[model samples]
Target: MLYAIAAVILSYLLGSVSFSIMAAKLVKGIDIRQHGSGNAGATNTLRVLGKGPGIIVFLLDIGKGIAAVLLGAALSGQSDWVPVLCGLAAIVGHNWPIWYRFKGGKGVATTVGVMATLAFIPALIAGIITILVIAITRYVSLGSLVFAVLTPIILVIMEASLPILLVSLILGIFSFIRHRTNIVKLWQGQENKLGAKKGQ
Candidate 1:
């Protein structure tokens, strides 16, 4: 019981360290949450702060997820459910960070890191496919949607434990929810592309 509680709280804090918000504030003294689509994630970072900052935020966010999972596993050992629990903890943290008023990024990158650690091969393949699609379509939301939707399915196919699969599905659903605004913009043909705007 103590271990579980500690893991959960630790994971959430890890996730809540919104690197995008921090990067924006540090690099330009602006709140990432106050601009672009008002999202504290990579896409919005790209939209409001340009590519360099966006890339940095993306990597850092992914790093947080990876760090949390690695830490949980390292501390808890290769116990059956600790990895899954820690992964969930990281996702929850990113979605509702304590450090940032409980508002955080959409959890796509972090989720990727989570699965990649637990299910390395499948996550790698999914990540490759996702990146290809994003590169071709210039739609981060679509790529993320692909990542989210495919992750649990892949986990299931890989024969991960039912518990892991269940948690992964929940994480995927959360990713979709976070990307809701992006979905709207995608349909309306108003979503931002993955490059510098003209004259910028």
Candidate 2:
């Protein structure tokens, strides 16, 4: 129990490290949340910074999620829920990082990391489709939403364990909630696309 609690706390701390902000500041000396779509995630990073910094931040964010889950697994010792809980803790930290005044990016990248660790097959399927969607539409938010909605369905179809399904569902809801503004923009055909100019 003590180890599980420590893992969760450590995971949250890990997730709280906003790589996008770090990348922006390191690469261009600007706060990421003040530019582009005013979002501190990979898509906005790519828009505000460049491909190199954006990709690095994205990968690092995913890595933190994976690391968090692994930490839970190593500390909790065969406990089924601890890892998933740690994953959730990471997502929550990413979404509302204490280090960043509780203002953080949407948890899409971290969710990818967490869900992939928990249920690889379902996450892979959803991720592939997500990539295709982003490729075709150039709308990262749309692709993220699709992944969030599809992963739980795939998990259900595959008869995954309850905790995995539950976490996926919660993450799905979080995605929709976080992207509500983007959803409206998408409906209005005003959402920014990849490769577009900032504030376009």
TM-score versus the correct structure, for each prediction: 0.90, 0.97
- lDDT, residue 183, model 1: 87
lDDT of 1 at 85: 82
**lDDT of every model, 2 decimals:** 0.80, 0.91
Clashes (backbone N, CA, C under 3 Å), per candidate, total 0, 0
Local accuracy of candidate 2 as per-residue lDDT tens digits, 1-200 = 99999999999989999999888888889988999988888878888888888898889889888999999999989899999999999999998999999888998899999999999999999999999999999999899999999999999999999999999999999999999999999999988888997732
Query: What residue runs in model 2 are displaced by over 4 Å at the alpha carbon?
Result: none
On TM-score, the candidate that comes out on top is 2
Tens digits of per-residue lDDT for model 1 on 1-200? Answer: 56756776788788888888888898889987777667788777877788898788878878877777776776675575776787888888888888888887788888888888878887888899999998999887899999888878888788988866887788888988888877888899887767634110
Q: Given candidate 2, what's the lDDT at residue 161?
A: 99
* Residue clash pairs of candidate 1: none
- What value of lDDT does candidate 1 attain over all alpha carbons? 0.80
